[model samples]
Target chain A: MTTIKVNGEVNIQPNLAEFEFKEVLSSDPSRKAVFLLLNNKTTGKAAILVADKNPFVEDGSVINEWIKDAKLRNLAQNDIYGSYELLMPEKFNAVKSSLIYPATDKHILKYRRREVYMIYETADDYKSITKPSIKESLFNLDWVYNFLDHKAETDRIVFDDPDPNIGFMLAPDLKWNGVDVDNLYLQAIVVRRDIMSVRELTGEHIPLLENVRKQVRRVVKEKYGLNPNQIKMYFHYQPSYPHLHIHVINIKYEAPGAGMTCIFLDEAIDNLKIWPDFYQRATLPFVGKEGDVLLNKFREAKRLNEE
Target chain B: MTTIKVNGEVNIQPNLAEFEFKEVLSSDPSRKAVFLLLNNKTTGKAAILVADKNPFVEDGSVINEWIKDAKLRNLAQNDIYGSYELLMPEKFNAVKSSLIYPATDKHILKYRRREVYMIYETADDYKSITKPSIKESLFNLDWVYNFLDHKAETDRIVFDDPDPNIGFMLAPDLKWNGVDVDNLYLQAIVVRRDIMSVRELTGEHIPLLENVRKQVRRVVKEKYGLNPNQIKMYFHYQPSYPHLHIHVINIKYEAPGAGMTCIFLDEAIDNLKIWPDFYQRATLPFVGKEGDVLLNKFREAKRLNEE
Candidate 1:
């Protein structure tokens, strides 16, 4: 096995004994990667190394070779796809290494199982369909409150504005691996608890929206060297949580759940400026995933047709 | 070389000489794939074959072997990235096959070169920045008129409505290669020439939007067997061309240029129905690519900050 050291440490052919084991920064089971922070004892400097398993080639010869050499322990089997832990002999090593089989696609679509339905939500539909669903979910705000109070993810917070009405705390999203700057993704959760979603926003909240947008851009520029033009800010209509938040992502990174329910922050502010009751009076279209409570409610109300 | 035959023709070991070349369905140079229609003389039936070059394994040995044996003919070199034609010896054959080098990424992003800027275009900005740029470009409509007149893509038309006020012609988008139903993408080009973009849309055009939306859904359902819930319909705020069109795509397919500038057709109709001059009164936010005239105008007018 080759000992590869990245981040300015030379001696690519150094023996594995020369390096001291450190801590694992992160591990992604789906991608079969373990990011390690190692110290090169010879150089007395820290080196970052990504121990990632190579993907199988699509060639028949490669597949046959893999099948011949692999000892698989089945994890699960459902229909056409199956999951397993493959223990295989390394190229120049006697020891077998274990890797998860049925490796996830590189460009993973998180909502592949979820079918998106565009629901034309009226104010009445909000009352009958969305509002009740939100109430039923009874989303606890303790975690959010903890984060705002500096009891959670304190070290991860990039920017924190304490002005209750127009303030938000920006932090790196859990989806990001924290290594790749190209795929930089962040989320800014509003400090105000009153506004649950974009549906509740009016011209009165334009300052909050603008503040988040401006501060996010400035902080990203200062910290990450990414220009304002190289970043995108948008709010999800049917967000994972009902709490009002804005997603900030590098323009180069194609974030999942971007197009379906995403509404640009600038567009939202512009609309509110034109008509203070724009979101209140307008018929908003949102994507509802399969088996969602709100989706069922929409179907029951005849707002969305039964499939 | 193994002559693999697909599409239920059996006899995977058939000689290459036994198959008669009919025609090429599509050839993607970037992906090094040639979709060919072949006739199996032995079976007396047509067969589809995709002759694609396998992607390189990220292993050091594989890359070293590739570099040692492959012959390259340079196409172009710009900075770090270069394009080439690779002629390499086949595994078991004396014949050398040709393939384009620097194979494009499978999930190809179209706007890598173009920087996306969120330009806030007010009514005045539209007149000063957008209108002049459109006028300056003088986008020729002869081809569009020709298509409308049945001089082009007549066979490709999936749905056609003749009402000039509320009519549109639906056809497969150029981006989608016709074979893959999972990636089914279509465009509905409006018949009326007066309405140029979403900016020009008003409450009066609600009927037209609804008609297009309804007929498109019906046609996709009838012809493609795609449920209304299985497809997404949207309009690009800053469309490729000035002429009005709505993009219809399979909800499963992550279409390029989707997340950016895409507004739901349902939302547009709902907005128009509620506010007679919703689009007219709203300040629009759109993405502007590098070197775009409107982008330059926006920069000059201070609508978008200079980067």
Candidate 2:
């Protein structure tokens, strides 16, 4: 299994590379990150949506049922808006917490439905169902990668990273000592089952992939003193997670700068440039420091359980 | 004798592949410019020390006698402290017109002496003199040539023209506009005798050199508007007229703005990279347009006399 580490926190997932992560509640930092894992039903684990609280109920199915019920009532609200921020209990089965409201006043019943969970049978079902989405995340990742590699070159050029599993891009907005620096972009596929299955297919060792992620986190934190905000860790086919491989992605949007740095594909980068389709377009919202803190807490809890 | 033309202007030096022109001192809208002529010495034209503005005195004998007279009287007041500015006209019978002063207050008479019509005994005599330089006006033409040849490039960078004879450089002191347009370095070398000699030695024709300078100028002006005081051009040896070659270089000290166009050296600038040493260290000065007006007026008067 590929273990993706971001800013020193480890995230475990199944062998599949594609995944999407997001934040459903505006107030909860621990539950701030939500992920959508997808692969063709022919190859990937069954689609399951997990909550920080009720890990088994699958929030994806609950959200789908709620949407259908709301449509029957002809709610006439744009509930499928890409992003909806609300205040509520962190999880589903928590003792009756006061219903949190959205910025708009319309949804009293929806407010009572605080955190919904659900599941889907196919990739198409997932795409058709979710409006505020994680499915389109991978496509955005590909776009950002293309832009960073071709046009962003300054008088001083930076070298591209050596690993194919891990792609690191600097944010255009980041700066050091008043000089604009690029924000970082990183991607890696995670697996939960046999690591050898991935190695035989992609010809890359799973341990090497994990090590690269750890190195990236150490370098970024120690050298740049910043963290990714939208972290996407994709997992498929559960026992929730132990049966899955987690592919981790870090994306920081609205990064603070105007400079762009190109990732040159030279002789040194030849081998890394050719990657498998599974690793293509899998993107995650990079969790910045707050998200990183939650991830570290999760990793510590998992490590203690294993011990 | 490969004449390189950027647009339509013909550069005259084999060493120079481009020219950029700017008027350093003009409130007028016309933006007229002047070119300095170097190596204009004629074999039989009587290099004279004009006590009463005569042009027919002996080249060496009369000059030496006059220098002797000034040296004896000014040995204490002039010799120990006073510079070439004080002794040049009195001793050598050369005019030190107030046309070519730099922006600085502390002027060096030694440098200004080079501005006067000093004779080069032989090409080697011209080669040996250092303080009163004649090399830059000859060398920077090579730099300009390299700058224009799409194949021209070198790790060697220039902050200021090394050879005053080859040409001069200037940048706009931008205050009103928030944007810095572009840094401009200009050089013009006038060659009647030296061109003839280099042609014989290198087996190259002279007209090819003339065409290159004109092309560089046209490209720069078309790309960036011919803004007054935004740039400056220096004529190599304008004291004597006719045969002239110039190297004009301009680089933006600060970015003008987001939309401003910068005439960048194309990636293919390698032609002048392999030139021989005939164009190195030529001496010339970067002077302003007030000086240009005086020199232009002088050239017009001489041209009228010739006609």
Candidate 3:
């Protein structure tokens, strides 16, 4: 296993191991850290954290932390349920940027592209995308899994039943048999271009530029109604992929990726104890739709980086 | 402050409360124990746990627990997250002659005649139903509370977020914060119903239906291309609206509703946690585009029920 430890936990690392595990996001595990793969020969000693997780990339505290903590630990039996296993690289730093809403023309272009991708070629495309195979099963959630197996690459499919209520999603091939059966949410793969545009900016920029991490989060939430707490973002500086994108994964309520909430799940539910407010606050960024305000800031920063 | 002690737990008697809460069609929380209203000088004090945490029921045990537990505390502290406290009633004992399916010509006719009582109508039917204000805000969930405040209810609305990835049934006036939000990923909902119905029939059901829960989860992974774990289900139940239903909400990896996966805004997500496998095993009698196999089962069940 090639070990690569990235910066603050925004960059996601998939659990390709035989079991499930959690890595810290920040100094205080509740904050954000990097997810690392600990191995001697493979990817070498490296770090992976989402660029979005860092607000200010230049700060020595943050930078030095990345430089100093450059070791990857083999996921111990106990680590499976602790943190999301995220780490950042030393070369990268976070910078805040101004808010710049996508131009109408640009919005139209993106929409059209998405529309084309959705519509595709035939009636079957529409049918397959819209129609759900709601065949009742005896034991397994087979239809969902089957659908995932088939449509793992192309489109996003949603299934609905009557009562006009509960729904589900089918992502690509994600495995969990015994060691990591509990945390069964999808793992999102994000690319670097999704967040950064390294242009040059001379004038005073937004102070929030340092906090590019939060901006990426706001965009993801606004565009997709993903809750931050349930999901963990991973960043990378070219250990595997070239661009620096954040991989966001959904950690089911039952998943140990919950950190403090895990404490609540372990303690509060049965004890009837109140969930610590900090857990609630910490996970607040994950609720609702992604906020554009944050996304715009990142986009502006990217634009300035290019200029 | 009407406290009804059940199993020695001081719960605000859901039955006696302003918003009725029930436990309908559940496998666990066996529906045998009688519940007293503590201070109900009005209706019969004796109540029973009705349902398990099934996805089909709007407010299953999951909803009731959260309201009686978390939200209630939040309300008391005056944290004021949003309006509309969710509740799960004790029984889904209200036997209905027919369960309407959203498909088939007959279903539509029945919906027009028996179920849908148009309390309000719009001059421009299509226009009113697909109003820009509602359309724009449907997926744009960040403005949820804001939209609720200004949404006009002069016409009945059926949510269809242009992007089929999301579906909702929002009745602003029908909510506590003066707005009720019920969003579902359409395809996934159908898959969940089928899975739930199948479980209802099969005796071998997990008390906590996590394994089977993946039926609908596939769509988030493959179809919409989301992090599967990122999708969260929120559930709520109200006796005034007899029956059960759950709202399927997806939290992006970094949005606000992330960390607290178990924390349901309403009863929509929780109820699914405990739904009996019998419900998942059972099927819908009517067949239509929406019903899938559940409809076929429903038809069989209807015949059996009639016989």
Place model 3 in a CAPRI quality band. Answer: incorrect
Q: Relative to the unseen true structure, what is the Cα RMSD of model 2?
A: 36.4
Best candidate, DockQ = 1
Which runs of model 3 end up more than 4 angstroms from their true locations?
A1-307, B1-230, B235-252, B257-261, B264-307
Candidate 2 chain B, run of 10 with poorest lDDT: B45-54
lDDT by residue (tens digit), candidate 2, A1-307:
3454534555333322232221222222112112212222333332222211111122334423322222111111221111111111122222111111111223222222232111111222222322112233232333333443555333222223434345433322222222322323333222222331121223243344445445544544554444321222222221111211233222221221101111111100221223332221211111112223323332343411111
The local lDDT score (0 to 100) that residue A180 gets in candidate 1 is 68
| Residue B83's lDDT in candidate 1 | 37
| Model 3 / residue B252 / CA error / Å | 4.6
Give a tens-digit lDDT track for model 2, residues B108-211: 22222222111112223234432123333343455344443323443222222333233322222223231323334433333223452221222133233434
* Candidate 2 runs further than 4 Å off: A1-115, A118-142, A150-208, A224-307, B1-307
Better of 1 and 2 by TM-score: 1
Docking quality class, candidate 1: incorrect
Better of 1 and 2 by lDDT: 1
Please give me the DockQ of candidate 1 compared with the native complex. 0.11
lDDT of 2 at A70: 20
Query: Please, what are the lDDT tens digits per residue for candidate 3 over residues B1-307?
Result: 2444544554342321321222121111111111111122344232221111111122234323322322110111111111112122222111111111112344333222111000111123213332332334333332332332335442433232222212223332232232221222321122121222221223332322332234334533454444433445433211011112234343322222233323232111122322223123211111121233322333343421111
Could you list the CA RMSD of all candidates, in the order they appear?
15.7, 36.4, 27.4
Q: Deviation in angstroms for A122 in model 1?
A: 2.0
